[model samples]
Target: MFSADTEQWARDTFHHSELGDRRRSKRLVQLASSLANHLGQSLVQSLKSPADIEAAYRFTRNQAIDPQAIAEAGFAATVENTKHYECLLALEDTTSLEFSHSTVRGDMGHTTSNNYSRGMFAHSVLLFAPHEQHVVGLIEQERWTRNIKDYGKSQNHAKRPYLEKESYKCERASRAMETRLGEGMSKIISVCDREADLIEYLAYKTSNQQRFVVRSMQSRCILESEDKLYQYSASLTDAGMRTVQVRQKGGRKARRAVCEVRYAPITVKVPSNKKGEPVELYYVGCQEREQEKGLNWHILTSEPVRSKEEAERILDYYEKRWLIEEFHKAWKSGGTQVENLRMQSKENLERMVVILAFIAVRLHQLRYLGLNKEEAEKQSCEMILSPQSWKILWSKQEKRKPPKKAPSLYWAYINLGKLAGWYDSKRNGRVGWERLWEGWFILQTILEGYLLAKSLDL
Candidate 1:
């Protein structure tokens, strides 16, 4: 899904972009290549020469360059890669990109609970191959700003048209993916959090025959039974017990908890005021059997869950939804530092954000590959690093001559962590994206000097 060569990947992604002019398209490829090579660095730090830095700034400031056009190129590339996979999980979520700088804030809208804070909301649909255990690419990204004047309009949400509401982003993304993927739409199963439990959204998916596994938010009315959706779900027979590993969030410590699984097929009635038909779907309920703080999931799905294995598969699909959250962190703070961008105008800020979004996916992919021991051991380092890069990294880290044969990805993963000052111990947790990128940054800097010296033949 991703290439080892930064320049080649950039060219393949943005070369055919229709950005008004051929020169603009060429500049997009060059700028993306430079940014991808540098990973987390800012524009001034990423571009080696002053001319390149100035060109980058100029490219962003161009009014003719549509941010959506830039993003569409990458989306097209992702759709092409989806052809190889038999099944994919399309994870959707929204994140706030806050730019609180005085110069840029006025150009943006309010974010989170703070009216004083200004930013834009980026809703992304990231494609992942479940069998491969790797991110394919970002197929859809919608960037928008909330009007500051409408800060206190929550009470009027029901009165507003569905198209005008913020929640429409999810449905819009689904439509975009369907149009883009065309015949490949059947291969994808949409996975989303509680925010996507809207009846309109679910109805759209079900009516279109789009498969989905969305966490239940509303205890909806059931057509056949007197009990509501959750009540009916609780009354179903317990299928079995399964242990699930919980990731640490906030102050919670990581631990495994046994959960009781229950599943049933139910027909959900549309709300009284809303004009829609009752939607029939499968429901899977998972609650921790014991523990003060435990895992509980009220999952709603279009996929059939007739047996324990099928119910577990639904649970696993929802669990992978956390990848989008980690991706947001990688984009905003961890890897890309997109929020740190100092573009003076909203247009330029969005232009840079779209470009960096792809880079963040690459960073997420690298960390994923490093963590999977089996996959890393089976593949060669050449899948991620250039010949000169692995050879140089080998010579520098091992304090010996470079080997003629390439090393395993596991070897490169461990040594990269070491270069970033990570202590290799079972007591220490897995290497994070930050540390992996730090090691990569150091290697790239050294590779630059090595290539320079070789060019001089000194």
Candidate 2:
């Protein structure tokens, strides 16, 4: 369906291109084609040679666009489209590629004179929903000033570009929030790890401003005792910990003891040790979650956890960040043949990831979303169900009634697997939309047959 409007969309995001621009003059499409192929591929390793422009070009044709500039144009369009639908939210940071390889070719993706090769430093952010499940944003690096250490100048003009670091979080997030504001999105919350604190989140808060649920970095921004200066660590490892007993459920004896910990606040100077110039603020880690076999350290928001209920809710939804990881896995399941394409530049690769991530996520959401069902026709989401679904679900819901504990989502997955006939497959883990549809149909059939049997008996 997106194919039908491909031409019009391309035109809106271009320059130096007339309808007569050789059908391949748009630089953005060339790049976006690289991205789309990457999205369609199973994994980064299996991407066919980048020299195989024929295949990439062919895919672009199917989607109805010029291959050469697809990546750039597509990214712009997806960002705009997401704003059109109010899907923007906080995005996760980039997963460093080739950072561990100790490569000699250290110029490509180094830390701007940090002499990091980090050969082929590509791949950027994957935007997602309010839950950060599916990607709704993609920010790639094109002007990374490694050897030169310059992010270029920004001017208010049609062709103005962002400084390299500006693309990180603050600037990109500001753009996203503004876009959503125009689209009328309410309750936007930006979540991130320690790296995002430098971005001016508080300044961007709209009267209906987006709230930051970002974790704090231990640095120049962090404060210590008497508001004194102390370098904070990224996590609880440096938080000075203690262990105390707490409640545990489902034990031989109720309220089994577990370890509790505390950490006082501190400050961390950024650039690690740059005197007189502060780059980060740390809140310090305060607690440790100890286990019998191992241990895991944790940190809370730099700001206070005002209400326990809100704190619990934050913890609950934060887990949703994992969904994007699984989404990336599924997206690349075929092989990152696209990654191997070796786009003209690393920027192309980053652009491709964001564009594809957005499409992959959109496809996922469409399945559960109703096309035209009125509010009343649908169940209350957690409790709402189709009449057919209700009949099958009600019995099991009744079986575990009263004193029985509520079932976790595990039951939903298990039942769907059985209903979809996925129980026999070796890769019986994730049931795709096809299988979900098969399960729903099967459930509907079973309910009908049982209802018929009862009527005859009566």
> How many residue pairs clash in each candidate at the backbone level?
0, 45
* Residues 66-153, model 2: lDDT tens digits: 2224344434544454654444444454333332322233335444324433433323344455433334444222223243343223
Q: Please list the residue runs of candidate 1 whose C-alpha ends up more than 4 Å from where it truly belongs after superposition.
A: 425-429
Highest lDDT, which number? 1
Measured on C-alpha atoms, candidate 1 has an lDDT of 0.89
Q: Which portions of model 2 show Cα errors greater than 4 Å?
A: 1-88, 97-127, 130-173, 176-186, 199-210, 219-286, 291-305, 327-335, 342-428, 431-458
Cα lDDT tens digits for candidate 1, 1-458: 66789999898877758998998999999999888888788899999899999999999999989999999999998988898899999999999999867778888988878778899999999999998897999999999988899887867999998888999898999999999999899999999999899999999999999999999998999885898887787778999998888888789888888999999888889999898999999989999968666788899999998998999999999999989998997897778889888888999999999999998988788777877888889999998899999998899899998888899988888788778898767654377777777888888899999889999996
Task: Note the Cα lDDT for every prediction shown.
Answer: 0.89, 0.39
Work out the TM-score per prediction: 0.97, 0.46
Which 10 residues in a row give candidate 2 its minimum summed lDDT? 1-10
